[model samples]
Target: MKRVTSLLILVTMYFSIACQPTLEETNSQLREEVIAVHDEVMPMMGKLKSFEKQAQEKIAKLEQEENVDEARVEELKALAFDLNKAYDGMFVWMRQYEVEDGDKSPEEVESYLKEQLVLVSKVNEDITAALEKAERVIGA
Candidate 1:
């Protein structure tokens, strides 16, 4: 009876250890989270271009007039630039991003995922802010 109990305990411990998530698994989860954040913001890309176009069209119309509101035109110009910049940031990040483990160590993979999360978060913020600014200027 004693021997059987010990064997059972050893088997249980082994299974428990084996069932735990490895560092690579944890890193894979982190990578998924990074991709999730990216996916959440990607659909807004078209709005960036649309808002930029509106800003440009407004600027053009204002520029053709003799009594142009320079302040408003400048604001629109800045907004347009911001929108385009945010749009470009997404593509740049995507181009630079890599998910393949390659020959990287687990620690290195974790570090890379953490860095990518931060970068994508910043890009997400830029996108949100630019879109909000556009909506405000374009009247909802």
Candidate 2:
């Protein structure tokens, strides 16, 4: 019975040590992660712009072609609009965001960074979806 209890206590202590993150570590990791997400998505804005231009050129060429499908052209236009919106959303968010610093407590900074991670994740999702839709449209 004594051996079993000792083993159990050892295991619990090991797990607890492994599972816990210090507040500073959490803050730093979350901040780096959120910035990485933003960096990953930032280049997509320029790609979106390029896609928009290509789409416009394609639409123009289609218009010159006889028997063009107006509905298809309209769909491309809508996709372009959405892509622009996604790009703008990310740019605006970056412009508006401020870094948490020494003025804030570690807990407050961690909380702020965690919130930013969610926001940046959402922006990344939006940009990815927009890029995928634009690619499909361009391919079609």
lDDT (CA) per prediction = 0.96, 0.87
Q: Per-residue alpha-carbon lDDT of model 1 for 35-91, expressed as tens digits?
A: 999999999999999999999999999999999999999999999999999999999
lDDT, residue 35, candidate 1: 99
* Count of clashes, each model: 0, 0
Best by lDDT: 1
Query: Candidate 2: lDDT of 45?
Result: 82
lDDT of 2 by residue, 83-126 (tens): 88888889878986777476999988888888888988999998
Q: Weakest 10 consecutive residues, lDDT, candidate 1?
A: 131-140
How does each model score on TM-score? 0.86, 0.77
Candidate 1 off by > 4 Å: 1-20
